[model samples]
Target: MIFETERLIVREWRDTPDDLDRVFEIYRHDEVTRWIGMEEPLKSPDEARTVMTRWQARYEKNEHKYGPWAMEIKASGIVAGTVLLGPLPEPSDGSEGRGEIEVGWHLHPDSWGHGYATEAARGALELAFGRYEVPEVYAVAYPTNERSIAVMQRLGMSPRGLTTRWYGREAQCYVTLPRQRAASN
Candidate 1:
């Protein structure tokens, strides 16, 4: 497991059939995919496998320091969704090079409203602040994504307004430093 919270076991996603199916199940929903990635839901099992392979490659290349990870509910052993900690992309306008890290989550609709996203994100933050010593983490979401915005607020992230920095489109941005650094400032 990459990390664990009271109710979650955040871990690397395997390339097995079951894991691919779980990825499809969670990402096939337009409701969940609309706020992330291509904004189009997966159309087939082949696409799901491709997605899993891409994520797995990222995991290997980063040596697990950053990438999307599966969020498994410990009580039920069901893979809930994904939690990501990675480098935010450089500004689309070429204003700057990459230097920021981001923390984000995407959960199955069935897993929504159970506080899993928040819990899983807190676990990611702990890993970032503790093991990786990331100075700060950012989260960007569509302005209308109230649920994700709420999670950021719950994590004590400060609103940083809108930017087209990371995702190549306008996104509402929030940022937080490690607790000690935040407190000292």
Candidate 2:
């Protein structure tokens, strides 16, 4: 899927070497990956390639679990990070439609404070809610991940009164779209 923003174009992984390299650069950053609860900053180029291979395979295996898209800047074509809207492998509850579409994003350390994640995420959400017609979207961030939590709040996602421990870290649960108070602008 492809979605556009004023400054960035968010779409599924194309698997070009350059695209793989850009995503690896961001994923390999110790600071950035850790913020997202990734234990290992992305390693070898070959490993990145393997990931892409799997991503492509998922498109056929399960459309709900597609490849994470590379986030590219419109002006320079530089990949800033990744934006993914896919089904949660497992959901907080185990029932029908429990694994609703989830929205997630990651970016290079240099891209921080630039609103790129939020920008790309807005585009992804439009596809999730508008194109796919998902009634709601969720985002979960480690309690220690203040930056991610802040972004979730900016997207108008609110606490859903749930929590979980993931990868040995505490996480906060939040949901957005069709809120009782008001919809996002």
Candidate 3:
């Protein structure tokens, strides 16, 4: 496991059937998938398995400090979402990408509005700054995603404006550095 909060446990994504099913459920919802880079909700469980297997393989390398994680609620042992603390995917142009660590999350709609996203993100950011010692971490969302924007603000990230570099579509970017994490620290 990467870390834990009072109400959540953050761990690497697994390739097991149960994890694949949960990942599929989380990524298959339109509300969750729309703002994510996916062109549409994943087509099937097979697709979720493929993605989860890839993450398992990457984590198996044992070189990455962080990557996509499964967010499990402490009281229920239910995975309510997926969280990420890692380098943003390199841009297709082969140019230098944002070159910063990133923090991101997508929770099941049923788990929304309960502060789970914010709580789990706080734990991830702690790892990013405390363990990983990254200078800065970023977050991006579709311009219209008010929920994630609010989370960014709660995390003390400053608005860095918009960009299309990561996903080839306009995305509002926000950033936070170790200095800004003082309050959260």
Candidate 4:
């Protein structure tokens, strides 16, 4: 496990078939994919396998406390969903990693309405700000995804208004800066 919150265990995902099957269950749910900008659920296990492989590889390639991590509830040992902290993909405008780190969460619909999303996200934000010293972290969501937007606000992010800065489509951007104390003269 990478880190542990009071109610969750965050860990790197493996590419084994059982783990792949577990992850597929989360990604293949329409309700979960809907908010993630996917119009349809992931259609096949191969598709999920590919995603799992990619995430595992990305985690291995990084030394920073970043990439997609599985959120397993401690008491029940259920894999709730995922929490991610990483550089945003290039926008349609084609700018590369202009130092924008994104924080996001995806929970199975079964896991919704619980505090899991907020708790897992708080762990990711703490890792970004407290450990890596990233100047700030951002979150972007479809304008209509109120549930996700609510999570961002609960994380103390201020809405920066609608923007096309990260994803190709227009999205609501939210940001939070690290509380670094000023140096005394």
Candidate 5:
């Protein structure tokens, strides 16, 4: 599941052979773990390694089929962050037939505002539409996260409604209609 965008590579998962310290380095980065939810941000590289290990196991089981993809920047070849897609059974409120896949992204804070989120997201959108036969894509973000909301807007997506149950709090729900609009443009 390696998808190459114009400037990034979205892959399933990879276990780098970096040193012990480096394994924790990305974890210890506050900016990197900001949007991630945990009782506390990652405290050390070991902790991050454990989390990534779990991700690896999940991918081994093909659990990520409807979830996130690792976002790697082509220029740096470094794993910057990840883009998430939602259609999973857990969080979904039985909305599979709704014709949409919830989209999300989390870039290291350093990668913020660099178009990486949008680029990687576009790739996910392409996959969702092209491969999944998904008729539409959607996203939900805290209303205050102006950047994510902006990226959704830039993707030609618009809000269908707002809901508080999404992330355990209110969020703006954005949606992109069927692909027919692509031809209208």
Candidate 6:
């Protein structure tokens, strides 16, 4: 496992049939996919497998320092969804790299309203600030994504307003420092 919270185990995605099926189950929903990526739900098992392959490649390329990881419930051993800790894509405009890291989550709709996103994200922040010693972490979401915004607030991230920097489209940004996290606790 990459890390553990009181109720979740964050770990690497496996290549098993069950894992692939779980990946499909989570991403096939439009409700879950609307706020992330291309805003398109995976339409088939093949597409889900392809996505899993791409994520696995990213995991290998980053040497596990960063990637979208599987969030497994400790009680049922059910894979809920993904929590990502990675370098945000560079701004669309010409600029030097800022080495900005981001923390974000995407969970199945069934996992909603259960505090799992916040718990898993707290653990991801702990990994970022404690083991990785990253000075700061940011989260960006569509301006209308109130659920994610709420999670950011709960984690003590301060709003930085909107920007087209990372994903080449305007996104509401929030950032947090190690010190801010301590104060929030």
The whole-model C-alpha lDDT of candidate 3 against the native structure comes to: 0.86
lDDT of 5 by residue, 56-76 (tens): 776667556754667778898
Worst 10 residues of 3 by lDDT: 91-100
Residues 64-133, candidate 3, lDDT per residue (tens digit)?
5777888999999889998888888787545687667889999989899989988988888889888888
Q: Which stretches of candidate 1 lie over 4 Å from their true place?
A: 180-185
Q: Give per-model TM-scores.
A: 0.94, 0.86, 0.92, 0.90, 0.79, 0.97
Worst ten in a row by lDDT for model 2: 161-170
- Candidate 3, residue 8: the lDDT equals 94
Whole-model alpha-carbon lDDT for candidate 4: 0.84
Candidate 5 lDDT (Cα, whole model)? Answer: 0.68
Clashing pairs in 6: none
Best by TM-score: 6
Give lDDT: candidate 3, residue 109: 92
User: Candidate 2: where is the Cα deviation over 4 Å?
Assistant: 64-67, 92-97, 165-169, 179-182
lDDT scores in order: 0.88, 0.75, 0.86, 0.84, 0.68, 0.91
RMSD of 5: 3.4
Q: How many residue pairs clash in each candidate?
A: 0, 0, 0, 0, 1, 0
lDDT of 1 by residue, 62-172 (tens): 887786999999999999899999887777867976578999998989999999998998888888888998888999999899999999998889899988776778889
Model 1's alpha-carbon lDDT is 0.88
Flag clash pairs in model 5.
24-45
> Of the candidates numbered 1 and 6, which has the greater lDDT value?
6
In the range 54-90, model 6's lDDT, one tens digit per residue, is: 9989988998788699999999999889999999877
